[model samples]
Target: MQLKKALKSLVPPSLQARIRTWKAERAIAVFEAEWRESRRNAARIQVRRPIERILLVPPDPGTLMGALGDDAMVTSVVEMARARNPEVEIEVLTGRPVASEMAVAHGLKPVEIWESPHFVRDLDALLTKRRYDAVVALGADIMDAYHDFLGSAKMIAVVDLPARRGIPSSVLGFSFNARPNPRLAAHFAGVSPDVRFRLRDEISFERFGRFSPATSELVADSAFVLTPGAVADDLGAWIDAMHADGRKVIGINVHPMLFRDATDEQIATIVQRGADALLACAETARVAWLLLPHDYRGRLGDAVCLEPIRDRVAGILGDTVRHLDGRHRASTLKAVAGRLDGVVSGRMHLAIATLGMGVPALCATYQDKFEGLYRHFGLPDWLLLSPESFLVEGTFRDALARFIQQLPELTRIVGARREAVLALSRQNFTIFDDVAQTARIGSAGQGGSPAPVQDA
Candidate 1:
């Protein structure tokens, strides 16, 4: 629209009116030709690189940052896949209109965004649009469209989370029922012969393996592969100030789910409880707290969902607690998180962003995803499962007390574990490399390190 508008404004009004009429007629003709034959004989441009053009499909769609840490984690799949072959052209295929701000932060710039997501919508159109040697799904769970897209791409569906018993009734096969549904079972069988699995956690591996007990390699969340970038100016200034005071900064991520799902009164209770714990810990220990809201949603389109809670914490803690919400990219958030002394959050990916960088974190919940990841990080004791009720149980203060007192050990453990996980995460790329090298989907003989398309 900007390009068209600018071009039009440069022409005289009288000439432009006539030009528009003719341009529309010509555009229709071009559109018809493009529809009929644009991609028909389009030569499959191949190269010697392990992979060529890659399509990344996220499980659900929203502005990437709305999913917060999830955006960084999913995009890490693109980063991981690209690591196998840096020159590979990458595109994000999702329902939301992708903005490049998130991708740019990771030193990766997507070539294009295929509309919508796979499954019921754009899967077929996108597959037919380009010959993708590889298609990777970022979300943990296995969806119904898993096999279809996997078979269409002639590769694997990377399962992140497993279909636990009775929890998710939505995914086709794994219902609360005694037996797996036959139709979904048939769909499950559609996985291509050449496919591979990079299951994020053991539970996902175990549950998915029940169907195809073949070789599903267990792995940690892809977020571990993301390296932090330089912190932004404003956040950097705050960190520097705290550093001048000789105070260690701890990131406090309050997930929107904490309040969005609760009533006003419940929200106040949660805020008071969380703020109380943070203030006690901060004032007593002489540490600064950075309020990081991983998810920004609800009223304003770009607003972080935890504004109310952030406001509450800020009101009490004053300048000691500052909120990081607006326009901060995932990479920026991760960079900020990497600087934190510790973290307490309800979100998984935020914890991943922090913990993956060797920062000690006490998650608000001990869920399956965290458990699966901590096993790989070798810091299983670092998390507290579902700590929402911890305040009421009078366990919040004591638990945090323990986390604070043992900060040195926690830091050492996380730093070593992050190094180990990063090493292991690199191996996750081998599956894509093997599949692409053997499949050899693109045109041949073009080598010598194809221009670095990893990022702009």
Candidate 2:
């Protein structure tokens, strides 16, 4: 009998399912083992460069949650670099407005800064400029698709390498997410000649071999800021439920500029509806207003706190949304998220931060990011309100009630997920030592000499 038939004949359906799952898991384990060994062999082959003058690039650093992980990656890189070699100069290629804001806040005084008028054109020029010793592609961007085209950099570090994308041998790959996407890593390893794909525990500069501490605190504190909000469809109903429950309602507006991209009517409609809702909800309790710090170009009514959100939003958007910048925002939204018995937010990062800090937040999402994070942590019961359905007041109230009821479970789940993420981060540390040693050897090989082994 054929192997497939023989296996099927020997096992019941349920037993077969378990066996198949086990076999798949075993294959992955073996693949990773072989891949790591191959990397070890490559590390021994001889590296020719000790990287310096690194550039950090990510997609859309100015948008709210779009830039959170990217900023963390950059911060980690800076910290790692400074620790490894304090004098190693660094530069950033980012959106102009966001770069300007980040410049003063973190020690991000880049030796060179490239502000892209168009992402593609500016990115090409920035990557083509004088040869750098290394380039660190921090986040998921189309530009990272062309890392090999960045001919000047001797060493390249990527956050994640998709399955079989054919990256060059010279680049070192690192998974940026808290956990490894083992299948993706394996596929990449199979394609690239000298790639070493490893599970990185902490998203850090030192962990990735840059070894700087210049921006560590920003990263460490990033996860604590998410405040959950309502789904787009159930906003009205959620308000009613809050009132019935005698809860104070905070209305947070965290989208792109309100009126600029919209026709006057569209802008007016949103404002009018928002104002009306605030008025209607005001009867139940007070309204605390929070706007995505950079989203307001024109000041709303007196209740809105535009300055702080604008300032921080300016840092992220750089100059693309320049007219929106003012006194930098520090997110008093945090104070709100901290004290609130519950939260409803459109901003996904805010939810992550808030939940991590033991706040119960309901997400009103229009995209995959919110749902992705929610599902990643197995909290499907929380609302994933769509734009159309979010207007319904009854739906909102029901969802809020359900969310409130599940508070205890939500806390446990968030706590468990946070632990898993931290544990994965801790596991990534070993990769750091491997890469650092590889660099030391690469440096010696470039000079055509065997490195002297120093007994530690």
Best candidate (score: lDDT): 1
What is the TM-score (0 to 1) of candidate 2? 0.47
User: lDDT of all the models against the reference?
Assistant: 0.53, 0.38
Candidate 2 global lDDT: 0.38
Per-residue lDDT of 314-411 in model 2, one digit per residue for the tens? Answer: 45333222122233222433433544455555555456545555566676664333544554356674467654333444554455456656656776
User: How big is the positional error of residue 175 in model 2, measured in Å on the Cα after superposition?
Assistant: 12
Error of 1 at 297 (Å): 1.3
Give lDDT: candidate 1, residue 208: 57
Q: Candidate 1's residue-wise lDDT over 14-74, tens digit each?
A: 9989987776555434432332232232233232347666555454433444565566766
Reference-based TM-score of each model: 0.68, 0.47
lDDT of 1 at 355: 80
